[model samples]
Target: MFARDSRLRQWLGQWLPKRPVTRRDSPATARGGQGDVDRVRRQYLESEQRFRALLESLPKVAVQGYDRDRRVIYWNEASTRLYGYSSDEAQGELLEDLIIPDAMRDGVIAAHRAWIHESVEIPAGELELRHQSGELVPVFSHHVMLNEHTDEPLMFCVDVDLSDQKRAHRDLEFATRFDRLTHLPNRQTFEADLDEVLDGCRRRGLGLALLYLDIDRFVEINDALGYEEGDRLLIELSRRLSEQLRATDLMSRVSGDEFVLAFPGVHREDDVMRVLHKVQEVFRRPFGLEGHKRSITASLGICLFPDNGAGARELIRNADVAKNQAKLEGRGGLRFFHQHLHDDLVRQHRLAESLERALDNNELFLHYQPQVSAASGRIENLEALLRWEPLPGQPVSPQEFIPVAERSGLIHRLGDWVMEETCRQRAQWRDAGVKLERIDINFSGRQMGRHDVFERLEAHLRRYRLGPREIGIELTENVLIEADARILEGLHSLHHRGFRIAIDDFGTGYSSLSYLKQFPVTSLKIDRSFVRDAPGQPEDRAIMEAAVFIGHRLGLEVVAEGVENAEQLALVRDIHCDLVQGFYFYRPMPADAIERLLVGGVQSLGSLSN
Candidate 1:
């Protein structure tokens, strides 16, 4: 390579004009003049070598030069490699006839003529040029025009292939619009498509329907079967839903186990109902996953365009509202958007705002409900039930405000307050000679998931000068079933420390008898629905009896809740219920009333039939 470079330089130097040396005054002066000429030639050769190296270094960028007549003057090695032509063949050829596609040849010539005649600079951008093999290659071309005080201008073009960049961009765009697990359009693409469809409907005077669906008890399923299985279930569900969709319908996975369907050109409500019913039918078949059959159910909500609001955002919001209503009523059902739903949303918003102030404003308090031994009628424990009496208007029921608290993320703070207050009150009662076996406090599901709840509870217990056994933790069935590793560890720690754990509202959720063995639980409380009509309904009696028998077999204390009359109490007593709590014994009352009952003795509590 060095010899070739030196030979090329010698050949090029042969055409250069030599400077006339001045008449030599002496031999020394002639020698100095010769040395100056040699130095200049050496510098010129070095500069040319550097320029050639720079051009060769740019292997990915093709460089080509053209003259005023639009014929190629220079082509580099990159140009040869990019266009699949030898550098010798590429030079001295018209760019239009060589690389420009037939359709673009005229435009290419026009742009070149304008650049040469009108001295206009050509704009640089992406274009397709043909390769020597006749395949089209996408490139980003930049044009450099140079004149250097000459009549004829020269244009040098630099092109870079865009195949890899284009492919990467396409892959990124696909990833953003689709779900990784289900390969369905994700929430972002769903909203974008909905906006476009809504605009078209407004212009064409067509009606549209939006259906929002949520898998019922999906969390419990995920907890039981594992996340991998849960993901497989989602993939299967997306495939089933796609098979049932019409060409005009679009579906998206908007949330974890939540899907939205958009149906355009629906002329009547019946059309929408027909499609939603079909969606429900998809869940009827059990998902066969890894040797297990999982039954699935969905709650669906429907909203019509122009009736539920014209905008996409408003329509989706209303659809979600209806979906929640259906879920609340029960799963495997459908509901349509209504004005009353808007009213309920507003009411819930106000109630959520009010609850934020309940703790600080002294509006939040607890009422003690006595759970007495069915055999002895002796009060065994006082369950601290949360009550809210706001600054103005009617007091909110726990059934109403608790859900609001959970949604608003105020449950953690509210629950902390409840725990401390309950412990403090129990201590105060103990100091005043009012005593019981233990005080039961309801634990929120939100609290169980928090890693710091144990530390917070320990602080409260220390502040009240109480031991772990002084308070019992009452958790619902779902909370126990869905308890994660950290929560399970925390519960076991509490249990080991002598805090009794009880399942509240048993038999309502996931009803897996396995939960009895899985959690560190010591007692079960039969929900009131079974006891309210136990004597009249043989089935209810049978259920209570079975619960009692199971509780005894598991060595767990069984308590029957909501025994409101003599018949109910007598029935529970006959069934050997360990404890009973209801309005019939005493409505949940203030601390003063509970203290009075505590001081009045067990016989005073027993003579309440008067």
Candidate 2:
């Protein structure tokens, strides 16, 4: 409507028949042809009547009749209501002066004259004409020229108000095509646009890339500030990113702190990298938020057109999959979409769904690996390892499913189950006069987020009438390093309660010694990678020896993992490591096997060694 509607003028140019006028001054009337003149008068009157009837059928349509001079000769009641002019006041007014906008008045006058003198008809469609009060009014108008053969030809315009329809169309377009806050293209609109670009790419044999960008730790930042501030941050971030995009490229705020961008004609990995570099540069600049400049980092995932996927949805999914993998590696990293990555994500998703029902379906169980005293060759402790078999003899390794559990938030339940089962088994062992000094269960950092973690452990211990000394909790070095105040406090309380605290797979995380100082840990388990080369590699051996010295200096017991050879075992013993845990002596076994072995007698490591 208004001047912005490019189609209105084109859509208004269809057929409208011209009617000839009957003039009493014609030659027929002056040449003694009174009958013919009378017949023409009757025909003109009949045509007027039919036009009036049409006006009556459309009460809301404004009808105005003008003479060849463009002076109003007829104005209907609807015209008075629509243009804020009484029929009496409008009768002798010039058509352009009365209703046409100043800018369009010239064109409207020229068109009217053409219809009157040149046998042209201004057909029907939408227009925005001025009202008496000067506001623009959207209307669908039909123009008809009557009496084209006579000098006193007249024109009538029938206009139907299109205000409501225009408003509705504008509102629907805004709702569906644009994001409310950022005013960027929405996910649906972006996808539809990508579909069009993809069609063009297919025809032109071109390549494109779709990138999924996610701001790291945005949720935490959002929670720290208020939601209103968060929204502003998003708006500002989107603006800056938009400034970096090319005019031809398209970007969409697909979710909170996540944007999807399409780059057409990108052919190589280096080309994709250059685009990603620009994106990373945007993040590197500090953003203004709540009177503060906060630096942020984002991870980007990229998928190529006709290589990763042909369709928009598939490409977006693949890019998102790559983004997730990049997130796993840490902030500001990028990953390319590949088939194997997509396949793994699909498998992980399916595994997570199945793992939800794993416990109740009795598909989950634990195998305990023993930690033996290197000095006495006697069992010192057992580490509980979770194992899963969705079907008989088809065990899914922890490497495959543990991450699935963590991502799915099933780790909390699984952790509790392991603690409860271990405690219950210990109670049963106590009942059979079998002494089990300490059994540790592993924990992922995700499990520590549960507010009831300490309570759940206490409940399990209390239910089984077990002491805290008999249950140890093993956490990876990374978990302890990333521990927040609540997690640190909870672990401290557990340590204070005499539940043994062990840092498992030590020296494998960032600054392991600093975490050992920060976290209240009682023992350290050297990572298998370090232990595997302890005998031959001086660097590895020196690292292990240093770890033992540091642990002892801190009054923490140190154990070596992956002791699968006599050389590795002897090295651990020579270093005076507190314990040795590996397949050399015994592999991880089910509870029943451990129970049978414990009941028989003291297990001799020397006799079991290969």
Candidate 3:
């Protein structure tokens, strides 16, 4: 047995015992010994074949075996498929030369030597492997050390393909960084790029320009043409803008109809202006949307690094401030960040802060402007206008604070307050035996789009014991044009609840006549622009007359806004306008003063009718 053990060890490098002759060295013992030896040999061959079959059957995983010296010993078909190498080419080749990239060969060889000599295990995880085609293939590798009794030490790597996973991850990343509509970098990626650019500019002490651009009157285009058409126009605009930008510069669509451009290193402020002028020139041509060639302009706000701000957030905020200033100054213009712009923003912030407390401090009040009937010239309806008188300061203009409220998301609470207050005042007038016609209250787009507006207003009416007919909801034309289904449902629901809907600033928006027909509107208030010059301008008079004619034909009342003189009033009345609201008949007055006028029983407002 000892001799047999040594001989088998020499043959197979494995220790095996020789079975004793069970029949005391007879013929039976010899036959049994031969049978056992033959059985052991056959078992080894079968196990080897099974292992080979397993490697061959794996269609998606590469099974490669290498020696301690990192030379390839075995390469399966899957290995060939993955690495673009045939078994004849891969086998007996150095693993480093076969799969390891030039930069990683040394490290991989060292790791393999450590695993072989020191019994240190190679850590298994996902990594990229180089294919013969020079393409990088992602794979999750599982390593096994084969230390068979008869065979030399070997390392086997079973790699599962991770190419699909990596591709999916790349696609997800792209979707996250890009906007679906314009296929441009979205706000997140844009802001990140801005931060990176700002850091580089700061380090080099370079002048950088950040331009914030808003498409002028984009809302009108969106309302006039459908949103689908608007999307096409935006795509075309993006293409045009991209054609004008340098490859080094970054342009991103930060918001709806708003884009951001970053110039990391500029020689002078004039360079920034030159780039902006190029951008302006890009939009000089019209973009054809739905067969209509519509011309659009951009309002640009420029802020310089190291001058306006040193950081990303500060620069963006200041640029936004300058942008709003540009819009206020006039559209189709550009403005640089200035200290006064910052001061104005500070003032706006202060005003917003005051407005938050104004409602609580009872500083808010409503002034009613009577909308008189054109036929009898008597007070028919009154429009409730909001006023704010914060203590220790002059009255804040609604034009200024209202926009602030809208931006700061305070419009929701402010609008609710105004609605509730108007309702309460109307209830007071009723209790005082003063006849109150329908009081028109303005509704911002924010208010109209709210899901809870209907419920909130219903509660207010119930609280004041007022019916919906006692008041009206006035919204600008853009509100109806941009209204989603939820807002439309809300409007229709309000109309069904006996609430009157008025399209304020009619003819000022880009909505087609179809919207006027589709919406449940009770009146169209001709915008002040037409009424302001109707007495002289033929175009103005023609528009005014058309507005009135359309209103009457649609079974809706027409109210001429900004009627500040007898001549304008006479012109609107001659055009057969149903109602007139402006300073000419009665300026916006306090509730008590309006109550006096209501109680006076005057058949005419002021001396216009008399």
Report lDDT (Cα) of residue 517, candidate 2. Answer: 78
Q: lDDT per residue, candidate 1, 75-138, as tens digits?
A: 8888888899887897789988889999998888898777667756566678889999999888
Q: Write the per-residue lDDT of candidate 2 for residues 226-303, one digit (tens) a residue.
A: 888888878888988888888789899998889999999986878988888888878778987889998888888989
Q: After superposition, how far is residue 269 of candidate 1 from its true place, in Å?
A: 4.5
In angstroms, give how far residue 172 of model 3 lies from its true place: 6.1
Off by over 4 Å in 1: 1-43, 114-120, 123-126, 133-153, 160-186, 214-247, 255-257, 267-270, 277-299, 325-335, 372-380, 444-459, 475-580, 600-610
Q: Using TM-score as the measure, which candidate wins?
A: 1
Compute the lDDT of residue 122 as modeled in candidate 3. 61
Score each candidate by Cα lDDT: 0.83, 0.83, 0.83
Off by over 4 Å in 3: 1-46, 53-61, 67-72, 88-97, 100-130, 134-206, 216-243, 246-248, 264-270, 285-296, 327-333, 360-363, 367-385, 389-399, 406-415, 428-610
Model 1 C-alpha lDDT versus the unseen true structure: 0.83
lDDT of 3 by residue, 1-610 (tens): 0011223224322221233334455677676777776887776676677667877898898988888676888899999999999999998999889887888878888877666677666667777889999888888876766563224776677788888898999889988999888889998888788788888877888888888899898888889887888788889989998998887788888889998887878649578778878888988898898897878888889898888887777877888888888886667978888988899778888888899999789999999999988766688889999999888689989998888998788999899999998999999998988987789889998777678887888899899999878989899998898898888888898888878899999998984888978988989999999889878899989988888888899999899999887788788878899988887788889988888889983433444454
Between candidates 1 and 3, the one scoring higher on lDDT is: 1
Clashing pairs in 2: 19-147, 21-147
| Cand. 1 TM to true fold | 0.77
Tell me how far candidate 2 lies from the true structure as C-alpha RMSD in angstroms.
9.7
| TM-score for each of the candidates | 0.77, 0.76, 0.64
Displacement of residue 589 (Cα, Å) in model 1 is 2.1
